[model samples]
Target: MARALQACLDGEVDEVTAQRVAVHGEGCRRCGVEITVYREIKNSLARQEVPDEAAMARLRAFGADLLTTGPAEAGDEAARLGGT
Candidate 1:
């Protein structure tokens, strides 16, 4: 049942399966709650904004700095920060 709900939410189910789940949800309290929760989660995710190009560029540069740093230097920095 949970798998059916998840498959419906993920759009992996066929139209007939979706219709069956919708009908089942109407009669089943637990399925109704699951459907409502999934709907809210989907709505919230759809409302999220992506990072802009400048923010992405800065993040990439920061990642590059971390990658370019020598292992010994990283170990020294980690040790300074009380990390083993």
Candidate 2:
């Protein structure tokens, strides 16, 4: 039940799995509450605004640049931060 819960909620599980989860949820109070809470969370997140794509792209580029920095440059950066 635990393993199939997420897939069932995502509608990625097969019919048999869906049935199993539904049946289990019916009998298990905790599973029913978990399903309800997850559905609420998913719905709440869906209603939130999407981020700015251009800003997101720039952030990704900044992260990529940090990753590609050489060891010498990282040491230089550390020295700039007053670290030996």
- In candidate 2, the residue pairs with backbone N, CA or C atoms under 3 Å apart (3 or more residues apart, or in different chains) clash, namely none
**What is the model-wide C-alpha lDDT for candidate 2?**
0.84
lDDT of 1 at 19: 94
Q: Write the per-residue lDDT of candidate 1 for residues 24-51, one digit (tens) a residue.
A: 9999999999999999998777765553
Q: Tell me the TM-score of model 1.
A: 0.56
Please write out the lDDT profile of model 2 over residues 1-84, one tens digit for every residue.
665798899999999988889888889999988888888998877765564677789999988888888577899999999996
Candidates in order have lDDT scores of 0.88, 0.84
Residues forming the 10-long window of minimal summed lDDT in candidate 1: 44-53
lDDT (Cα, 0-100) at 80 in candidate 1: 100
Task: Count clashing residue pairs per candidate.
Answer: 0, 0
By lDDT, who's the top model here? 1
